[model samples]
Target: MAGTRVPTLQPSFDELSEPLRETTFVVVDLETTGGSARTERITEIGAVKVRGGQVLGEFATLVDPGRSIPPNITILTGITNAMVVGAPRIDSVLPSFLEFSRNCVLVAHNAGFDMGFLRAACQRLGLPWPAPRVIDTVRLARSALSKDEAPSVRLGALAPLLGATVRPDHRALTDARATVDVLHALFERLGAVGVQSMDELVHAQRRVSTAQRRKRHLAQGLPAAPGVYLFRGAKDEVLYVGTSKNLRQRVRSYFGRSEQRRRIRHMVTLAERVDHVVCAHSLEAQVREQRLIAAHQPRYNRRSKQPHRGWWVVLTSEAFPRLSVVPAQSPQLGRTANPLGPFWSRAAALEAVDALHSAVRIRRCTQRIRRHDPDGTACALAELGKCGAPCAGLESVTDYAAHVMQVTGMVAGSNDDVLTGLHQRVVQLGSAGRFDDAATARDRLAALASVLHRGQRLAALCGIAELVAARPDGSGGWEFSVIRHGRLAGAGVARRGVAPMPIVHLLQASAETVRPAAGPLPAASAEETSTILAWLDQPGTRLVSSTQPWSLPARAAGRWQPFVDAAAVARGSLSGADLRRHAVTG
Candidate 1:
């Protein structure tokens, strides 16, 4: 026993401080009758289990494949039918090999080929296969050695380059032993890149950019919970804002294999720190993310930024009402006027305005006029009877005021007379063979219907000062949210066994009220209102309570019924180009 050292037992992979040195690895190689696992049979199986550079055990066997080995396979692996005639079948030999490689991570040059054969054998024999953690030396070598360092990553080339104790001779045992050496060589290379644990080694195989690797520290300390994360630059300015159900995994992914986008790669390089705001649930996280992106206008975010720039459809408060598209921050209007939309674009709002104008003879002139201003002149549209010519004082103020009332009633979703008039006009145009004009009218009707539907929905939500909603959280609990004036005010979780009344009350009491808008519209932007609507629409969500009343019409008040029928008729007769032109105009 003098001067002789005994091999020490390695620690379990989970408990090991240095898993690369302490975990057991079973390097495997197989010789088969052919390449396909489903069609071919294994002729030989070779595997060597090692830990801390010491051999724990070795498994090798000649398997009787019950079929003829191809000439080419015999020449390559030197495994012939005669040599395996008296050998044990795979079912007899597989149990011993499995025992030898138990509690070890399987390693192979091209693991799919070897593992596929073993799994097939297990399936054919009705044996339970222990699905071990696998590591492919091919992927490891590709990650460890660059193209210049090794022109070819093939096992035969890598075996000699890695200084293997025994060169691969196409035999299973020799190839398996060679692979073990290559695996060790890759571990050594991986250590230089700060990969020590088995998990780190596996993750290192992904091709990550140098900048992303350098910023890995920014992801540290991110909690594994639902939250919104902000990637801040060197000056602490937010570069990106995102939400995730699992903050730690999501943020860490930016430095790991999943981050392949070039823009995100560049963002990672600029990000100096990642800050997060934890949320009780994913819905809350999403709301917070949208709010943060809208507030900070992070450089990397493309959508939902500049919500204040949205457009609205408003009826001017003149003696003769005219619909117009105005910015969200438009100047104060007359007391008689009513605003309907926070539409995504001015063009979209204009489509709705044109729909109403075509049906009613409200003045289309843009100039502001006093009741009896004599200098006002009638535009050509007035001469053609398209307008009542209130500018030229051709129509009485009483008649114009009546038209204005009808327009206001339509916007308020209380009447559909204007829509009915537009539908009649569309039918007349189509019967007269003016298909293009008919198509235009149909498009305007659709635009108006869409805007009115959205406006009614948003107004109903905004009219509520306080509302509570809850839905199943998939964890034997309920997720609750509180809204104040169409904005998310608070959110929380309630367990299954406990009464949710207290939690609901707590959320309701904590909910913050948004400041009322000076105009008729809600202060919340379209994006904010949409976010709240989406949460409310989730399956199983129910209104627990509300302080203010809410009611949406069972159907829109506009001549929507006639418009629908007219659209159906127009669609059947109009050319595809005409229909598309109308759609694109909206």
Candidate 2:
């Protein structure tokens, strides 16, 4: 399709700014046989070369996927075997594509997915993937769109909602054109936030990457318990708020050793310190997390806490007016007489209500009597016995109130009686020949069970806590701990007075790896940083005491010497945030 009759109505590249139009952006899209990276293959590739804000040329070709396209995928992308027949394989076309993209940035709607696919294809071809930088219009839209705009963030949702007036053909070129329009509109809108060059965009993306990395790392050591965690940066300012169970465990996960550990390592390098609060239960933790995340507006967490913009579960006043989830910012929240969730998403709210109905058999439909006044009949749910048909006047107000009480009970994580009844129903279904019904009942029972099982469990060894410290001896030797509850947890199997402490200390010290900070902290002085590194490079030392874990005494100078020396000699490289701030200032 490169040289065919191009659409005349398409906007010319000259309409864009000199820099943007001359950027040689490869406006690209890929048609995959399925969604999964592990299981799917790309069937078509499409790109249009834009320069001087005009489409200089176009490129598109189907590929023999070497496997049957799933029927659903065929329907979605309209690409079939016949379309790709005799078409060049990815290997035949990728080389030329790479050459074309050389020195030019890539552009895509969901660029991550596309880049992943491209990387996979390159790997299959036994070629080193040149990961040229990419610009994602999807990211741009989220950053650029105002809060008052429609509650749509998807590509198809964006065009009409953004007032772009572009055709929604789902073809590659058309999609690319629409994206260009969106980018143009955003640039026009991004007055102060406008990026002057491609490098600036790259810098912004790195910040995002760093934030995501930190979140994932902190999540690593999270225990199954409920608690709250904080994300702090330089000057001890909290950058984000989160709640989790098992504080140490959750914080540890953020620093998990993996290729994707960008945020964890970056943040750790930048962080001056950390703080946390343990919660008694998961709900308490969640509520606290939400409040804090909303209050702090952390850089890393998803922007879910806009004022009056969260989601809500609305119970309508009319007969059979079904419970539905809509934005809290919407007028729908005000109209509903009864509602359950101001949940983060409509899906989350619906899931909550569904669990309530499944557990307590609460009628989600509105009152039958009220429906008649509104000139509507019972909904399908009420007619099908899924609802109690309050709209039909079959259930009294007292009865309806009882159902509402049951739902409230479910949401509050209380009402063991209702949960017991639900469990009994599941047991009965399983004992009978209704296996399918039993399975569904069992799932619902599990959901309800989790809500009730939110509180903390006392550790059996809670009576005693131990602190252990380790320091490198200038040679290959290390010294370590055996402290317990502000004292030694126990005496070790050491010969004579030494006790068997060294071995235990080493094991404990190795288990507790420090996580990197998420943002920049003031850089350690050259001497201090070097000393720290030197200490780290030396043989491990263990600190042991017979006291509570938190009561372990700080290590003395002799023990700290190795680290001190390392810090003195080690380089004090600029942290991720430091670099960004510096670049901006410069």
Candidate 3:
């Protein structure tokens, strides 16, 4: 036993892979009435079944597309409308094709087109799509054959070179037969390059990098739990961070050919170790991932670079209050009466502020205003009668105080002056045939209403010191969350036989102590709090207990539904040209 090393048992992902020689390939081809999967219908289905180079059987059928074939498509595919007069419809034929291709890997030239039609048919017929393994001959040919050997990967071009007996002429059966020959030719080429398993054949179209293939060693013993995962480089720098419902399967996928992202592949290559944090629930995993991203700020993670860039509308505390849009965060939330939002855009926050301006003529300028105006002069807005002219002392402090009270009530989720004013203005504009002005007013209403709704909901939850919520975890157990100040303070699962209240108390005891932040998101980041709110809103969640009253806001955004829906519809209806115009103008 001297100078001997005992080997540690490391699980290999490839242990589950079956050999290619035993694998069945259903080389398929489809003739369609048109190119679009949504609009067009399948005209013909042809599949040749093969195992280890021996032909087992074939399934070929003409489908009644249920519509007239376009002349161009008919001319191209040679499948005339008259030819499919008595043919079975796709619904009638799908069951038989499903039976034939069962447990077989699908091979096709430009697989997306054929698979799109097939999957769409499954969806339209209210049948589940058996998500089968797919291999595209086009990609395979590109990988195996050089441009000098074959100028094009088209079936017509390669059928002769690959020694295919059947020539492709756009007919489904002929093309399907030709595809089988192409598949075998590519398989033989792949064999020389050491590809010999079902997994390898499926992935041979695009080879996974050597670094990716070798890095499976780093994925050993990853737990099958909801968690955050980190890929750390040799220098102990965190290269990337991500979360998954099944950490083991998700991390293993990174070392496989399915991971096609250039950045991810490079990250895997540079990765020296895989680190993970297992969480009791998805909410915890998500929050942890976000926190880790903020702490480490890994170069590969693109989303959370500027985590607190979301905009919030705040009211300045001064002689004459003005609406101030600040980035929603602790540091940015200075001297405001309950900041309004994480509005996603500065222009949208400004729009909401302007909506309030329309209702109460607050000063819309950044210039400092004194109670006693020394200049006694007005700006352009005041001259045009748009502003109350606080700088010019045209509006008294008492008058402005009343307007500021309405603004504060709105901010505290108690007033709807902005909503009422904007909605009525939209109605007035519509009646007067000022359609464009009405639409503008409607957009402002929607923006402000949405922000108010979210702010109110968040504030109600954040106001609570401790709240317990429970939902069935779908497997005879209760999933519980202890929320303190809008953030997920604690989360755990209680089995069926256990006393749930005892577990609830334990969760409360172990929960993170959240300090109230100055802004709407009191305990955690907006992203984390929003995710928790969504979890609690799921249909079956029950409020187990609460320390404080969690009541809804006084003025709900529900009354402004008409303008909100119209705004949504208008946004959805905007053409690409209109979108481009808006983007440029905004």
Candidate 4:
């Protein structure tokens, strides 16, 4: 089997038809005159055809590179100009090599480099160069061997580490045999490491190389320093938006894993380009990410704003600001007294108003009833004091209109002034010795304090958290959380057609509670707390607070505030001082 030329085993097609009993690989090595693709030539080619991971045959030949061999390369590979003066060139030998590589995964050390050279050579020779996939043993070895076992990943270093006996030869066929032996050793190691498929093996190599490169890059500089990283698909669509304290490091993680690299490879193959924006602060990067996510709606972003639905309407023309539900129609301002909806549906609007009526006194019947039926008593709700006595025709429409105004003002959340006025009334009651009414006012203040206290939770998390209350259909409510930096923060959805006041307070509470820990924030140079606060102050940004709870429609009450401070408490970062500062006492 050694020098006497073990006859090349060429099994008949029928014998080869049985399912392979072992894994099969084709081991190959090329000896070239130089490294440059333009000037180099394959002076010697060697391959061992394997079946079921067993070497079946070996092919070896010397090729006339057509150009004179470099003196240094001749010294290195021991294939001199005289040696291949009359040998068949690559054009003549490529046909047999392709046939040998047929139906098998090609194996080599640094396989891509070798394949690149082979493809270039084949292209030059006008050969078809079959697009056969290949396996790289160098990559396999990186994951297989302990760092201390081999000084380098070179073929010479691997031969001894594998302990596969081979002649001390660098000639084409000898080197090919050694590589095949080394490859089998690597396959054994890979099997031990749970690698099973050709694709898995190749993918493992890609991950190893990528991870190594990433680690190297990180070591060269601070990874979490600050910046924006962009991921783009082959078609140049943004795939993901991320900001990091260390842009270099975070970007590398996406490319370092086999699964992630596979996705990136898919993207890169389709990608026409790449772009990135470096920022002075991570908050700025976050703002940009949100803006982009809203703008482009990239597929990878977690928080996508869907169109809002559900609305509440009140007719101003009616004396009591007749509350009603409206279906989602084209966007238009409410008719004078009739505020069109924020209701998800007419039914939801009815349910909401009913629930609010129970929580806070609001009349629901129309005045037109008692006007026409002056003799009959008012509707049942009117009898129950749930509706003004307009139905009984006892109360004038003008007087009925005052109660309706109260209902609308209470529901809109814009009546903070009213709440303050109510607080003043509580003081007045306390002075007048109206203990019960004073106690009720005190309770309301406590509720407001509870609402404001919720904002204390934001300090423990690592990122910016935002809560958005949206009606998916302009009627019903949906809640969302926007986590930026490294914290969890979210706000509850506001009921449709409610004044944006509660929503605004809710956002404020979310920000206060879920803000990242007061450590060095990511990309702090680009954005500050003031910047984020200013952005929050923008029009249409919603908030929530408990100050006007009873006045709020029931639909808006279900949305819960995200408590980020709980995490901070668990972490010991929310010290007594922090908690005291955040806690509100009535």
Among all candidates shown, the one with the greatest lDDT? 3
lDDT of 3 by residue, 1-586 (tens): 0011112233343444677778898999999988899999999999999998999999999999999999999889988889999999999999899999999999899999999999999999999999999999999888777789999989999899999999999998899999999888888886765556776666667756666766876767887666899999989999999999778767877876678999999999999999998777677788788888988989899876566668888778678878888876546585566777878889988888888888877888777787775345688887776777878878888888888877777767576776677678877777776666766776777888877777778778888988889998676778788888887778787766666778777788778887885666667777777878998899999999999888876676655566566578667777555533332111
Residues 1-586, model 4: lDDT tens digits? 0000111223332232222334466788888877766767788888888866667988889988898888888778777888898899788898888887887778887787678778998899788778876878887787777678766888888888898677437687787788877877886876543344453455556545333333222222323334556566666688766677555444444433354545444443343333455543334466555656556766656653222233444543544345555533323322333242334356645654544454343456544454443554667876676665665667766776666655444433323333344456556766776655455454444333232222112121123343332223234432222334433233233344545445544454545243333322222211223245444444544433222211232322112122223323422443444433333212
- Please report how far candidate 1 places residue 343 from its true position, in Å: 1.7
What C-alpha lDDT, on a 0 to 100 scale, does residue 244 get in candidate 2? 60
Candidate 4, residue 51: lDDT: 68
Lowest-sum lDDT 10-residue window in model 2: 454-463
In order of appearance, the predictions have TM-scores of: 0.74, 0.34, 0.70, 0.38
- State in Å the error of residue 200, model 2: 2.8
Ranking by TM-score: 1, 3, 4, 2
- CA displacement after TM-score superposition, residue 103 of candidate 2 (Å): 1.1
lDDT of 1 by residue, 1-586 (tens): 0011112233332333347778899999999999998999999988999998889888888999999999999999888889999999887899888888888899999999999999998899898889998889898888778789899999999988988778998899989999988888888877765566776667776788777877877766777667899999999999999999878667767876567788988999999999998787877888788889989999988887886677776777665567777788777522324576767888887777777777778777788767775457888888788898877778877878888777777767777678778767777777777767877787777667767766777778878887888888786778888877787778887866767888787776666656766554455666777788888877888888888667865445433645555566656665676664443221
lDDT of each: 0.78, 0.52, 0.80, 0.52
Off by over 4 Å in 2: 1-22, 163-165, 203-586
Please say which candidate is ahead in TM-score: 1 or 4.
1
Candidate 3 versus truth, CA RMSD in Å, comes to: 9.3
Candidate 2 lDDT over residue span 82-142, tens digit each: 8878888888888877876777788888898888888898998899988787988777666
Report the lDDT of model 4 for residue 518: 31
